[model samples]
Target: MQRKIYITIILFLGIVMNAQSGKVGIKTANPKETLDVNGVTYTNSLYLRNPGEPTMTGGSFLATSENALQLYDPNLESSGLFNYLKLSLTGISGAGVTDYDTKIDADKFLIVVHNYSFKMNDGTTNVALDYGDNGTNDNRQGSPDVVAFKSKGTWHIRARFTDSKLIALTSANPGRTYNNFTIDLYLMAYKRLITKQNINDITSDLGGTNGSSKTVNRPSGF
Candidate 1:
């Protein structure tokens, strides 16, 4: 019994010392990470309670102080939503602007908030102060088309003005040099990784009875 106990202590010490330097692997001879596993994965509620992990229970997550959402928070009429994408459309002119498309990963949701628009040039001189070319006749539609949303996991935008402006501007100037513009739009794409329970928590916490899709009145500049 004394010899057996001595051998067990020797074995335990050997294992403890060896494990200090060796990476641990499950079903693997060599592990690339500190703790590596092979094949399928399974978890339970208790698994999420690991130390230093973010709370599994979600409600009004406050971002870090340097987060951009905090900066824009004051500008929004209704307080909610987080930034997912910051997209810019700049220095566009003469029609035929290539479409813009961004595809996010699976199970993600995208929301847009159009903010501001600006012009680099006034597009030709003097009497340009006219509003007669507003898609009425499809004669002078020189502006870009409205933003388009499609679900191949992408958000798409095409630059084309009202049909009337297309006709009038193309016919009159041909080059359409008088319509250079730029715009800033915000994309609020929620991460797919957000827990469903947290999502429900948002609905309950915010008192937002309107459901997921809230109507946004787009400014004319965009």
Candidate 2:
């Protein structure tokens, strides 16, 4: 009988595999971690994709201009609350019921104006009234939060804390006269997502028997 000797060897390129945990390591001789990258690893770009994920479209490293990023939740409805925060400044005649929906999450939307000077209706145009530019912002005798000064004079309104409805600019006196400058507001309609059905349910849960005349609407024919 003749005896033969053979030499065989297996090698890995600085990589380790854990079959139990399904983990891989790089540049590590004895890899005890999933992905063990020793030194600085550079990459030009990166991408994220979910083949069967729900609601999440994807992600990318390179930025785009138009509609590049999107997030969607199936629960949100088209009629749900939406808002535009960039509000237009108009003369608020006191806290009158201007022309808009005021009941938003107990007035979640707030109003503020730029401190930039404006052409007041009055002949003398004053510099924009800012926080530091006190004594001039209001006629309330140095009241901090007051926005208006004279009732009919030119008052350049600066920034204000977010409060009140989009259209209704609440003043100390709701009946005061506001002149010049048509204001528009940036709507923030999504502070709370409410549906028509939710309103009905609330009414019924509170008082109505739900199936009685209280909850039901009577038609014109009736």
Q: Write model 1 residue lDDT over 114-202, tens digit each, in one string.
A: 54333333432221211244423332323445554655666675544443222222344443344455544566665333433322112
lDDT of 1 at 180: 50
Please write out the lDDT profile of model 2 over residues 35-111, one tens digit for every residue: 55556565566454532234322332222223332233324433422344444444532222233433333323222
Best by lDDT: 1
Model 2 misplaced regions, further than 4 Å: 1-82, 93-178, 181-187, 193-222
Angstrom error of the Cα, residue 119, model 2: value is: 6.1
Evaluated at residue 213, the lDDT of candidate 2 is 54
The TM-score values for the models, in the order shown, are 0.35, 0.23
